[model samples]
Target: MVEADARIRLYEPSDDKLVKFSIGKASMEGLAVANQSACFHPFTLSAWVALSCIMIQLLDWWPKPEYGLLGYLPPLPAFGCWGAVMLYLIDWFNRPQFEDASMDLLRRPDVADIAKHYQRSPSSGFFILEYSGKFVGLIAIDASKDSQSQDTLMDKKKLSSSLPAKKSQGTSSVATIRHFYIDEPYRKAGIQEDLLAHAVQHAFKADSAVKEIKATTTSLIAYSQKCIRDAGFALEKPLGKLGVYGWKLDLVVLRRAYWEKQAAGTVL
Candidate 1:
């Protein structure tokens, strides 16, 4: 049983290639979302063409003795503006996909950076699901403060205080699940559920102060949302059309209380 369990386990430094492939797959999905929603802008294309022509003209003139440095001046603004517009378009293409979210930790360009991130933060964890020694899926958990407002937290505190004493000690920290992905061939095999459970367990083990586990997904990704919901999370909020799901770890406190009570009884 231990040997079988070892196949699906936490990510190691040697699994860099697998981690890169998973992140690339997730990035491609984000790019696909951009491509689908992309709009045609004739003016933007025309501006780019116009700037290119001016830059070419300036370069041609710069070789002439009379033009000299004066030729360079004419193209500087055009070049700068063109570069800015190109960057804007690139960002615009990707912005709608992420909706200005903070998943940058998962979308890192370098897999080594991601590995370094997990190594630096003892409170963070990454897990992979493997079959026959080949990695097939991946997920990660990150520590963060609750995004809820102070007033909302206060309200929650008041409500919890009214509950039985065993359940009143709520935690303020949160663990967020990110970059969850499964290979196409491995889909629909219940691997994602196991990966999620492993991620949550790893998070709780890594940071006992974490009071909740949260995840966010777009409605378009029905399977992803279903996997989260099936793993005992519930919809906590709606970000436009996107859904934020969370699982409160109140049971963590209750379980500790029960264990302490048993210890006290034994002592008595």
Candidate 2:
């Protein structure tokens, strides 16, 4: 009984020390909570293998001709557009959906609507950016075959140059980037730069003789402008209005520099 009483007394909380004892217990609880926190995702082995295959295929495309009708098709545009919608939803959940949001303010009604339309029409040339098996962003290219302005832009060099007649009449191999968006958290982690570097490298591997890859971005996209510039794309001109509504649509032209002075390359 005496030993039991002594042990009980030793373990008992005294009134005078109760506050300090509670604090110690709380500190331990806080540490326990912290230790239970989750970690950021890392890429898996299967993902790495899939990525390797994609890299091989992308590089292998360089030397071959882009087959007609199928070559330039943006795979699974519906899925890509939905992926973009998911990204926007993530953004909205984290931040306020401002009334003057760029999508709302621009020609598009809203980001979700724009994404839905693209999914249905499938011409926006959008692709999802997945990192560590998570959706990180979206990349889009403007490759509408009927875009006269883009066609004119691509053809301007050949039409205006005084180079050899054969070179002038040959192929006009070029492509334009239209949209690129990364989630806010993923913006500064060099993912954007890495993606572009990989993309450009893949393009080069596809065709050693392919010359250029260009893109246009609005000055309003300040963050994107910096990203594009950092990726070795240079600004060319301010884009004028889109249509006769005289609705002023201003954008900056960005071009990627490539040297392909070979005769085997054909333009799309």
Model 1 residue 210 CA deviation in Å? 0.9
Candidate 1 displacement at residue 107 in angstroms: 5.7
Please, what is the TM-score per model? 0.50, 0.36
Q: Clashes in candidate 1: how many?
A: 0
Residues 199-251 of candidate 2 have per-residue lDDT tens digits of: 44544444433345566554334456677776656655566532111222344
Model 1 lDDT per residue over 158-265, tens place: 767564523112333666665788877777777777777667666666657766666766534446667776655656656553211111211111122332343356
What is the Å distance of residue 191 in model 2 from its true position?
Answer: 1.4
Off by over 4 Å in 1: 1-6, 30-112, 120-123, 144-172, 241-268
Query: What is the lDDT for 123 in model 2?
Result: 26
